[model samples]
Target: MNRTKLTPLDAAFVQLESPGVPMHVAGLMIFEPPAKGGADFVRTLVSDWRKETRIAAPWNQKLESPSRWQLAPCLKTCQDPDLEYHLRHLVLPKPGGQVELGQLVARLHSQPMDMRKLLWECYVIEGLAENRFAIYMKFHHSIVDGISASVLLMKGLSDSAKDRKTSPFWIQTAPEKPFQPASFKMPSVPAMLGAANNVLKLFGRSDSLTTLRSAPRTPLNGPIGAQRRFATQNFDMTRLKATAKTAGVSLNDVVLCLVGGTLRKYLQGITALPTESLTAAVPMSLRAEGDLSPGNSVGMIYSIIGTNVADPVLRLKKISQATNVAKQQVLGLEPEMRVPYSIASFAPAIARMLTGVSGKKKPMFNAVVSNVPGGRDDKYLRGARLLHCYPANIVFPGMATSFTCYSHAGTLNVGITACRDTVPSMQKLALGMEEALCELEHGLGLEAHANPRSLDVVEAAL
Candidate 1:
């Protein structure tokens, strides 16, 4: 049996979890019905998954922390795990449309994972309209970050559609070395001094302090209820790339502009637009050199969304500048020091959890925006064509909404998760995103010349 202690960053995610806040990251993958379709097909797949008696190292492990001295929890592998307990099969209610499936997923996401067992669960949903099925899987933040999860998923899927016998991620053995706790050694005096110097340098930076300051209070920055609403829409990658080319900015800048414009429109509709622009905590992957081990290895950088700016072109310019500044700040830090600096940047979030602050209070940022790059090739699962994969992320105490962007097979899928009470109509925000993109295209003078295929795909999906 393998066992390893969680890093401070990983443990922090666990400690931050509360009944109202479930600190798990989930994904919704829709697949076309298999060639040999029937209720029996699902049962057979579950049986195949169950036949593997031995649970994988990380999947089989459960967290254990006995005393205050043990701040980091250890993952102790279970000898035998009940596959049926972790993998579930469900049928959507009649007229199993996207609306019904979304409702079920939101409800499932509201509930916390059973920590008494492993820190993950998977649900196979059937009865979707259009001969489609879906898989909703969630993992505790401590288990896998966005990049690692993407890597794991790609490893499980096949690049060629002809390959149908490939096993799912859970049943496959880990490709990298088994996880082992790093050997503990007391730091030398010089090493300690160096760390101290880095800490002082990090805090001395102006941008670091700005990240700590409270963001402008808006309706979205309020207390969040347990209920969640998830909305998804896909954009044509070719169209976005063309827009980026015309604007002379990165694809990410184009995305941020879209989000900024959408947020401005949505908040304006409700008469809650803030005078100052909204800021988002953008997560950056911090994978060490040649390190492909699975676990959380990420840092955060705060970026202004340029919501205060009215013109679409001006908003894009402002967002580009803000993102460039944030990246420069991150680049200035030593690789080893980035994690510490990242943890320090979350001072406001940690404080909110500790003080039980009301949602009405201003937040450190308006939301968390993440962009996880996916494989470019089309993927298939057991002869079933993969339609779309949308990310569903967690919402913290003060932050009512979060956005996750994943690009796959020439499509950019944007998933928005929010507290139902705070953001009652997430569909409005989703529609706003499309409108924002169209505005950008028009502003850049690409509306007349750009290929209509990209916009057509988006319109069809929505």
Candidate 2:
């Protein structure tokens, strides 16, 4: 059996998981039916995946003695996994549509993964209104982060539409030329001292230190129950990119603007709009240049998404400025110094856990907004064309809502996951996001020909 040690970040994810909060990241992929309709496509795909009894390295591994270690967890691989238990098939009731699919996914996501077996599962769903099929797959946060998960899924897909016979990710074998694993060595005393000194220096920075303080509480920040609600919407990538170019801002800036406007409208409707701007914990990828290993390599930085602004264009400008400031602060720090900075930011959460406090009084951030870069190339799984890809992120005790956007195949897919009680009207929020985009398009004087596709209608229709 192969054994490996989990990093500190990975271990924290495992320890932080509770019955009410399952620390898992998942994705929903909608696909068109296969062109050749001779047999059951899903059944054939599952049969092909089950051909190989030997599971891959990380997928075959499970936590070993999880509660024994406080800082790090160890993994042990099982030579063979129970395919019947890991792979599942489900069918929706009559008149199956996006609503039914969203409800089913929310139910599936509510259950935490069993630590005794592999930390992932795949569900093939059928009975959509348009004869479409869906795939819902989830992995524990400790196993893989968003970027790594996207990469893993991309490996199973083909860049060309003609490559219909390509093998799935589970059945594919490791490359013949294995990457050389870095040798392990103990850090020198001087090196350790220097690292500690750098961390101390970061704490000395007034801005960095102030960021550690608690953010003002909002309705979205509180203790979360086990139930969850999921909603999704899509936007045209070309229009967003064009707006960003015209505004001299980044694509992420445009996304945050939409979120800010939506949150503002939602809060106004509920009469809980905070006078102060809302803060978001934006997760930044920390993977080394050209490094694409399957593990967690990310850190979070807080940004003030100007939800208090009344005008959409003004909100966009403020968001752009705030993101720029946040980016500059992060870029100014040395690469080695950033890890300690991130760990230090989590101090408040750790303190809450130790003190047995629920943290409803003060939240670290109102929500999490993340933008994951998905390649522009059209991808295909077996012979099915990928329609939309939505990401489902985790929600913790203090943070009840999270937003994740993935740009895939010339479209930007937005996913919102929230606690059922905290955000009961999530579908309204999803529709509001579309409206925010439309407002931006009109503000820019490009509404007549802004989106080539009918994104507004399609997003709400879904």
**Top-TM-score candidate index:** 2
lDDT (Cα, tens digit) per residue for candidate 2, span 104-181: 988888888887778888888888876788888888888788888787777778887777687756554322223557
- Each model's lDDT comes to 0.76, 0.76
lDDT tens readout by residue for model 1, 403-451: 8999898988887899989987777777778888888888888773333
Residue 341 of model 2, lDDT score: 57
Taking all chains together, each candidate's TM-score versus the true structure is 0.87, 0.88
lDDT of 2 at 314: 82
Error of 1 at 182 (Å): 12
TM-score of 2: 0.88
Show model 2 residue runs off by greater than 4 Å: 66-70, 173-214, 350-358, 448-462
